[model samples]
Target: MSEAPIRLLIADDHPIVRDGIRGMFTADPRFEVLGEAGDGAQAVELARALLPDVILMDLRMPRMDGVTAIKELAKLGNTARVLVLTTYDTDSDVLPAIEAGATGYLLKDAPRDELMRAVHAAARGEAVLSPSVATRLLGRVRAPADPLSARELEILRLIAQGTTNREAAARLFISEATVKTHVLHIYTKLGVNDRAAAVAVAYQRGLLTLDNG
Candidate 1:
């Protein structure tokens, strides 16, 4: 007997995006587009109601973002695997979604065949990531073993928030030279030569987080 088509729920803020995804998946016999949601809240609701085998989730939404929705689903014991489809490839976006229990992360620019394969993999509870995201993840995984000291981590966070070395020095009651030294140490430890790359690597490796407060 033929297997059942994979049931799918799409959650994206854009109507046209939803339309395109729905049309693409519905055209395939191996998949079924069960429903569409305009935001994470609606996605969570529909996911509970429909119990789709996979959910194509977008990162940014109205009520809640994809990561929060994924966390909520996990908390509520929802069994559907989440596959993130978004334009964002930054570590800030990819790391949280994956950490929040996303089964896969795919860029919006991915080919139709790749999206189909990602959906299939997600339905099977496998992890999938776009090539760029995979490379970023691999780099983080292979990062140098030098861990940042507590003060260096603090200075890195301040830099991530757009603080200048002088401002960080003032905030920490340290000399500007000390802050610069710490910044350099952070760069070396994170395997990056610049402040932005250091912060990005920090977030990717779970050393930094979005302060909701």
Candidate 2:
């Protein structure tokens, strides 16, 4: 049996842009454009009503912006993953969208293949960002001071080196519970919510030297 097509809702203020996106997805058998909205409010309403598998949202729509829409949709308990498509690639746009619960961010000029890949990735709960944007965002942020104790820093360095928490604990002669506490502290100090972000922060802040392997 064939797999179900990925259901999508497209939201963009510009008719031509929305039409272009609609045409691109219509040509793909793996995707189905379930609905289209010309503004953020309509997008939120349609999303709540349709419950699509994914939403392709443009950031600067009139009436309500994509970020606001994303925030509101999240509050409504909508399950659809939001994938932000916008011309802005700066940290200002990318970070706010991510904080608003967007699962992915893609440039509006992204090739059809990349867009499709992002949509599918978002559907699976993975975070995606344009390479250039990711680089810029990662570069600007300074790493926090070693919030963890000296012992905890040792464990985090090991974890950043791909060691399992249990492995790190054993190597440190500490219990797994202690390692977990350190890991939590690392996350808190970094203001990051996931392992990937934590790793990026560690690498950028020089907490984990690249040659630590």
Off by over 4 Å in 2: 141-213
Candidate 1 lDDT over residue span 1-213, tens digit each: 999999999999999999999999999999999999999999999999999999999999998889999999999999999999999987668878998999999999999999999999999999999999999889878874588788988898898899999999999999999999988888767667788788777877779988710
Compute the lDDT of residue 92 as modeled in candidate 2: 51
Compared with the true structure, what per-residue lDDT tens digits does model 2 show for residues 1-213?
998999999999999999999999999999999999999999999998888999999999899999999999999999999999999985456877887899988998898899989999999989988888787667656542445577756766777778898898788898999888888888877666666677766665567777862
Give lDDT for model 2: 0.86
Reference-based lDDT, each prediction: 0.91, 0.86
TM-score, per-candidate, Cα-based = 0.80, 0.66
Candidate 1 overall lDDT versus native: 0.91
